[model samples]
Target: MSENRLTNILVPVFAVILGIIAGAIVMIVSGYDPIAGYSALLYGAFGDRYYIGETIRQVTPYILAGLAVAFAFRTGLFNIGVEGQLIVGWLAAVWVGVAFELPKVIHLPLAIIAAGAAGALWGFIPGFLKARFRVHEVIVTIMMNYIALYVSNAVIRSVLSDQGFKSEKIHPSASLRSEFLQSLTDYSTLHYGIIISLIAAVVMWFLLEKTTTGYELRAVGFNQHASHYAGMNVNRNIILAMVISGAFAGIAGAMEGLGTFENVSVKAGFTGVGFDGIAVALLGGNHAFGIILAAVLFGALKVGALEMPSAADVPTELVDIVIALIIFFVASSYLIRLVLTRFKKEGK
Candidate 1:
């Protein structure tokens, strides 16, 4: 690999290693056995077919959520409202799935599309305000999160309150469940939603790397004044980027609504997936393939953490500390690069 490529790959790997080392030190200080803890973690993640499937299932939404954040990041935006967008998207998809009566061919796709549309519409507002009024997107998106949360709760209770705080189960026609796949994994919730997430990743890669619009978005992101001087419509691109980013987050919610949960409930607070996505994006360097790897790693850590308390007598919160450290190292890429550069110079 070229030096830059090597750096890109090594930086994240180095961060992960550092995080594990830090976690190990903490474990030792707390009188826990780090080796046993790590061993149990590995066993929980991949020692069985069921665990493997569950790990994949958990990571599926992280991929989309990470992409949502990364897409916005690519276009000079920080879509902090991904949590709110995801909530609305889940509500929209479930609403469509339960309300519609079309054939599977039409119904399933419609529900997914509806979720994306809801997210896009949600994202567009902040983008429009940023483009037109020069309002900061972060502030607007933060406000939108609460609005989406309360509005969704009220709408669900008013319309789909057959259950106490949740909506009715969605129609089978719109479900992404796969009996064959479930059977293969010994009845885990691993569904065809993974296929959608993978396809979306590929699509994201193609769009960003090979398309003119993608180039324009990146250009504006890197230098909005320069892009404007080049005759690119910076404002339009900003809105488009946010809309697309929100659409990705919406589909992530679809995975939960149509595949894992099969129903929508009133959320007590923001789903941590969107917030976790920020970490994933940072760790993955905002690249499509990197995002996939980061999501799987995160998924494995999450599933594996459950086993830590019982198997190794270690608190599951240790895994959270490791994750935070990893994110910290990833975010401080400049430090890692400086160390590498220093080593290279000394070697020369």
Candidate 2:
């Protein structure tokens, strides 16, 4: 492999190892057996076919959410409002799914399209602000997230209030469930959403690798002034990138509505998945395949954590600490390498 490829692969792998080691140290200090804790965690996530399927199910939305953040990052925009866009998309998908009486083929695609459109609209706001007014995207997206939460909840309450905090269940035609897959995994919630996530990853890779539009967006991201001087439409690409990113995020929300939860619920704050996407994007180095692997790691961590306390007397929160340490190590990889070099020199 080329040097850049080697670095990309090794950096994350080393970070993961360091994080696990640190977590083990913490476990030892707290008088827990690290081996038992980790063994239980691994078992919890994959000991049974059902557990393995559930881990994949949990990862489905995360892949799309990470894609949303990764896409925006590649295009020189920080889209922190994915949570808000996701909320609106969830509401839109659920509304369409519940209202439509169409056939399965038409209904499912229509609800998904509505979700994407809703997310795109939310993304457009921040993109427009950045392009037209030179406003920073991060602030705008953060504010928009709460706006989305409150507005969506108010709308759901006004219309579907009888359901008490959740919208009506979507029609079977609009659902993403797959009985075959469920049975294969002994009745896990693993659904067609994973298919969607895989398709989205392929699309993202093809777009970024094989398209002139992707090149222009990347050029603009590298240097907007240079791109504009070279006759590229910088402002247009900015808006387009956000729209596409938000569409990915919206589709993630659709997974939750149609696959996992089957309904939309009123929430007081952001969905944790959006924030998790940031970490996933970072750990994945903003690559499509990398994001999938990162999402799987996170999914395993989340699922495995549930069994830690009962099986090994380890707190579930320790997993979060490990994740945070991993992020810290990844971000500080240069320092890590320097320290390793020093140790090698001393050994010599």
Candidate 3:
């Protein structure tokens, strides 16, 4: 493999390892057994059919969320507003699900499309500003996050909700839930969203790697002035890239609305799924397959953390610490690369 590819793979691996080691040290200092803690975590995430199902369920949205972030990153955009885009997408999907009475084939796809459209619209604003006026996307997207959060909550209360803080459950035609899958997994909330997420990963890969549009977007990301001089429409590519990125994020919301929850609920705070996507994309090196693997690891850790408290008497917060440490190491990857280069030189 090329040195860049090797570094990309090894960096995340080492980050995970170092994070786990640091967690063990913390556990030792707290008079807890690291082995027992990790064992419990593993069992919780994969030991039983139910846990396995839940892990997959958790992974579904994560894959799409990571894709959303990774897609924007590849196009040289930092889409911090994925949280907001996801919220609007969830609301849009739930709205479509409840309002429509079409056949299953039509209803399901329509609801999903509504989510993607909502997310795309949300994404377009910042893209427009960034492309047209050179406004920083980070600032625009961050503000939009709050707008999405409050606007969604208001819609739930005054528009979608009859008397409660949540919207009505979606119709069966629009639902992604499956009886056979549920029975197979001891009634865990696994759904067809996993299939959708996987398909999305493939779509991202094809769009970014196999198409002329992808080349233009990537070139714009590399250098806008150069790309423009090379005859690529830099502004259009930037806008298109953000729109596609937002669509991915919106589908992540559909995974929750149509698959897991079957409805949209008013939130006291942000969901954090969109925020976590940033880390997922970072750790995955902004590659489609890498993002899938990263999402799975994150899903496993999140699902497994629930077991730590009861199984090993370890605080669930320790898992959070480990995750934070992993991100820190990943962020400081230059140091890891420097060390690797030095070691290679000595060996030669």
Candidate 4:
């Protein structure tokens, strides 16, 4: 058990280290100061209170998005529709925010719940198809993504438009603001979403590791044939897994709309968060705690990329190159295992 635990931790750590080393080599070949670039990246993400708050803000969506992918992965499903689910969640939350007039106590939670429900419904389509028709979830999810994008844009233009490419601002009552924190850090948009994310992590961990339903889901994931032979309802579990995953992605969208953007707009492009979540889920080993750690790392990279070019004269795109390399290294873990085994044999 200890060896397994050590291997689990070392895999991601070594992958990240190798990725950074590869990134440094690329930077040197490109005539850039790798040390300075990395220094700027670090400072930009954690140099001061403002950057810390921004990092937290960026991490909010990543947490939920990572959870979305990780949850589906646990059930042996690939949820490529998280991008669409996120968009629909944003639309639902913003629509509720503008269409209703209620007290703060009722309005905010209502909008958030509605957003999650919308996302779950979107996820249900592919889930139902897969359960009933043996459809490939990958193809169905990819198609659903495009459908969600176009349909969401149409809704914004035709029904939800407010004389612009955006919806009306959410009512102040429903806004997730932090006036106390604002007085301390000059009014950053970081709010109570961090708390939501932390709570979600705990809840997911409990649900997956400490519940009968979670055991059934994992049994189905490990061997659907065996699960069915043992009398577990595999089809229902599949549908439920996708719906739960979509609900998490929907919460990510709700956080972005209500806590960050405060409104919905005609998205000129996909958020791409759903796709990123795949990499996050893989890097984190699809564990809830691991996902949170992975999300924070990715969030730091994103926040730091903005300041790298301006502060250190490195191209912002360098961060993208580094992230890509990290993903590649993680996906190709066989190389790392080979190296580790060689070292162990030599030491012995």
303-344 per-residue lDDT for model 4 (tens digits): 988888988789999998999999999889889877887887
Candidate 3, run of 10 with poorest lDDT: 1-10
Question: lDDT of all predictions, in order shown?
Answer: 0.92, 0.90, 0.94, 0.87
Task: Flag regions of model 3 displaced more than 4 Å.
Answer: none
TM-scores for all candidates: the values are 0.98, 0.96, 0.98, 0.97
Weakest ten-residue segment in model 2 by summed lDDT: 335-344
Cand. 4 Cα-lDDT: 0.87
Error of 4 at 37 (Å): 0.4
lDDT for 252 (candidate 3): 93
RMSD (Cα, Å) for all candidates, in order, is: 1.2, 2.0, 1.0, 1.2
Misplaced by over 4 Å in model 4 are none
Q: Judge candidate 2 at residue 28 and give its lDDT.
A: 93
Candidate 2 lDDT (Cα, whole model)? Answer: 0.90
Specify the poorest-scoring 10-residue window by lDDT in model 1. Answer: 155-164
| Residue pairs clashing, model 2 | none
Ranking of all predicted structures according to TM-score, beginning with the best and ending with the worst: 3, 1, 4, 2
Compose the digit string of candidate 3's lDDT tens values, residues 251-343.
999999999999999999999999999989998989999999999999999999999999999999999899999999999998888888888
Clashing pairs in 1: none
